[model samples]
Target: MTTDRVNGIARAWWKEAVAYQIYPRSFMDGNGDGIGDLAGITARLDHLSDLGVDVIWLSPHYDSPDRDNGYDIRDYRAVSEKFGSMEEFDALLAGLHARGMKLLVDLVVNHTSDQHAWFAESRASRDAQKRDWYIWADPAPGGGPPNDWPSFFSTPAWSWDEATGQYYLHLFAPEQPDLNWENPAVRGAVWDLMRFWLDKGVDGFRMDVIPFISKTPGFPPIPEGGTPQKHYAEGPHLHDYLREMRTEVLSQYDVMTVGEGNGLDQAQMRRMVDARRGELDMIFQFDVVEFDRGEGGWPRDWTLPEFKAIFARQAASMDAHGWTTVYLANHDTTRPVSRYGDDAPGWRVPSAKALMTLLLTQVGTPFLYQGDEIGMTNFPFTAIAQFDDIAVRNAWARAQKAGTADEAQFLARLNRTSRDHTRTPMQWDGGPGAGFTSGQPWLVINPNAEAVNVAADRADPKGIYDWTRAMIALRHAEPALVYGGYRDLAPNHPALFAYAREIGEGGLCVVLNMAREPQRFALPRAAEPVMASGADLEGREIRLDGWGACICRWS
Candidate 1:
């Protein structure tokens, strides 16, 4: 029943499936070593199965220096000792498959840890065999970095190598040296490593910062007052390289491939997911998430019309054959309830349920981050030392050095928008360390865990967990919800977000109150209620409480 084709779209399992991401270091602690491991994940398989998600996009667990929370890869094939051994990883993979769930391993080939053997050899000598494996350039005229390019971490992208007499480009932290995708050997290495995982039976790959793989020739300088990321994103050889990957690796397996598209536009993103182009299955564009983000990573207020326009524009970009992804939170983004829905004391539960309704009913492959089902809110971070994300730490250091660091102001922004909020331990029960670890957790657990743990949520009949589970069930059963044509029913409504999804003759209508005030929305026609968070119907108008969401069928 879950495999039926709808709206004449291609019958791809990935299209119909729902994916959940697991950030390993915070998911669960198996060895009681204060960190999450594969064994703990295997033990928690039943929790995911019960949630009705079809795919699991596991975050990076490969061996690393923990510089960027496993994004810096030391070894592509070896599972990190902190996470577990190779045997435990295999067991965890088996556990997911045994429960009818697929695995999407994080592929962070945009860069590798400086400790990686290839980088070591590359940095050894100018004439080394692997010297070209990474992007390296001579120093500028005055003997500084090759160019003025800035990293995503807010540092210089070029790091000087004293011993090698040159600079290597790192679009991220210096520890993560960018791989030269232009080099055939590097591309071959990536393909081989992918095959290594595929041969192990992993279902797919969630490519990390994949669009940054190609860089413009000549190492051009970024324009002053211009976006730094724009200079390197969607380079000349991006599609050509993706085509090569499709032919060399992805074509051989029945696996899903989604790239992290950080700096791409709508047209560029559309090209990546177009099946006929044979580049990738889909790419994650950040328009919806970044829409509310202001300059320098600050939080900003956004209007409902603007938000609707973003989704409508994104949905319109995909044709009947093309597909996109729907997600509000991931390892890099803030919590959905905190960002999109109200997370206040009294409104948290209803708002979380409403956001889940929006996520699951959307026309794309939906991905839920860890703790999203239980309505986990952001951590009340008071100091910079509590942050585990390198980006935050780097930004804070830069602020302090520039004499612009205001303690209260920075904390406010950090509490509102830091990625560390999503990296906290998954709350299993109302116990110490949120029952995620018997010993001390690597990061402090959120204090609200006692009230927001999975055990507590699942125990309540009207909790967020049940609402999310029911929504997932409905999406899995209804073909229209999976591949339906989307229409913004109230495009100009200030506070009411109403849209209809149609597939052939049958479809569903979704109405959401995005503000704190109650909203009365008029339906285009009469409808039968399917499910709702907190909504009431009076005659031709549906009244929704603050952050209320409802789904219905055409009468």
Candidate 2:
């Protein structure tokens, strides 16, 4: 394909697009029910479109029991009554499509709620037709779980079911039973579900925890105190499963399909997304996002080099391959400004914009979490009782049990890094409920709503929101940015981070100052300033003030 044709195909209107992620229950509520609904999302489609988002990736709002915050899906074909009805969902889709925007719904097929019909039927009797739909095995001779695999949420991966007299496999919470992807019938059923949604006009799917779908057979136990994930995660047949999914469902449509490949490395990722691979359109790699959790997981201390190294490696790996999806904040993470940038007074906006510069200039499709453009910071919760996220609550309890720290201190850390940070109500304005809803919000709105909101920032010419819009526009206007290869420019510069994206004679250099003091750097003679996060640059040497970023055209 020619470059133009490839751009046309890969861009998919949705590819050149910016996608905003909405955590439904916390986005906005139209009915004063303390829960955000499809109607609320429909009502705000205009706001998203106005913000230049070409697609909206709503986190799961399917019929779920909320065990893992809607990730434990009970019905793939139906909308959760708590979120709204199918009719409401249809309206939301219609609204988005009408506004020339696409919608990427969450596809959580790796697991299902324990109450799902298939699971219920499968657990009812060994002779049930769907008995093989979910992974189930007899307990050990001593009557315990079949394996020593630990759940992602810190419990046994296998849960005993008294009614079934067998232990069901759950990679996450006990309430979420993993589907048996090894069974052709199960894969067929899930593919059917995918087609059903595609038929309904969903632009694409953000396949959830897709890497965990296929597990090693035989239900072998992990060696004591070992990471069983190495054995069970991204198992032998994961690529087979994805390829089958592509052949059966994804290939049939001209839509985007990004897999949430939690543990995939560069080689596996290339196989999963390369055009010849026929597996997925793209994959969301966590090498960059996982830095916040640090070495020991979740609460380990981190620094600038640690964060930069991960992102740099991830970016290089993606460029080495065909494509990758990039993101700073998502429903699973805290806001980037709070976690990565200096969120104090005057520093927050520039720091947020610098992060944006870093991501948008990299080689990948950039995903912007809702409210991230406005520099939304993390919310503070004094007590565990205030947190609505199941993962945070579970981690807090685990930390306390491990005697990691006192309740107050642990809860503070939870508040800082919890997924709840992204789940908080969107800050639209300083008005009622941060202009998100007319009534009470499902979760606490960030207290800095007045300082960080769409309305206030949109009015400020130099605000982070406008800077984000400019950054996106720059990417759209420059093919070198969207399609070119990436190279880190000043890899070891103490306070300066720089990279170049080049395509033939077209290319651009992106320079960002990570420090808060003014610094000057020598640039190539061909470099000419095209845009800057703040201030202006000239000649071979340019000075950047505190968290500043500049994009220069190289001809």
lDDT of 2 by residue, 386-431 (tens): 7887766677678678888477766656766788888888887898
TM-score of each: 0.98, 0.94
Q: What does the lDDT come to for candidate 1? A: 0.90
Q: Which stretches of candidate 1 lie over 4 Å from their true place?
A: 1-5
Q: After superposition, how far is residue 165 of candidate 2 from its true place, in Å?
A: 1.3
Question: Which ten-residue region of model 1 has the weakest summed lDDT?
Answer: 1-10
lDDT of 1 by residue, 1-555 (tens): 244456877778998899999999999999999999999999999999999999999999899998999999999999999999999999998999999999999999999999999999999999999999999999898889888888989799999999989999999999999999999999999999999999999999999988889999998877777687667888999999999999999999999999877888878888888989999898787888888888877889888899888878877888866788999999887888888888898899988988899899887889999999999999988888898899988998999999999988989998988889899999999988888999989998998998999999999999999999999999998888878999999888998888989986679999999888988888888888888778976666888989888888887
Cα error, residue 178 of model 2, in Å, equals 0.7
lDDT of each: 0.90, 0.81
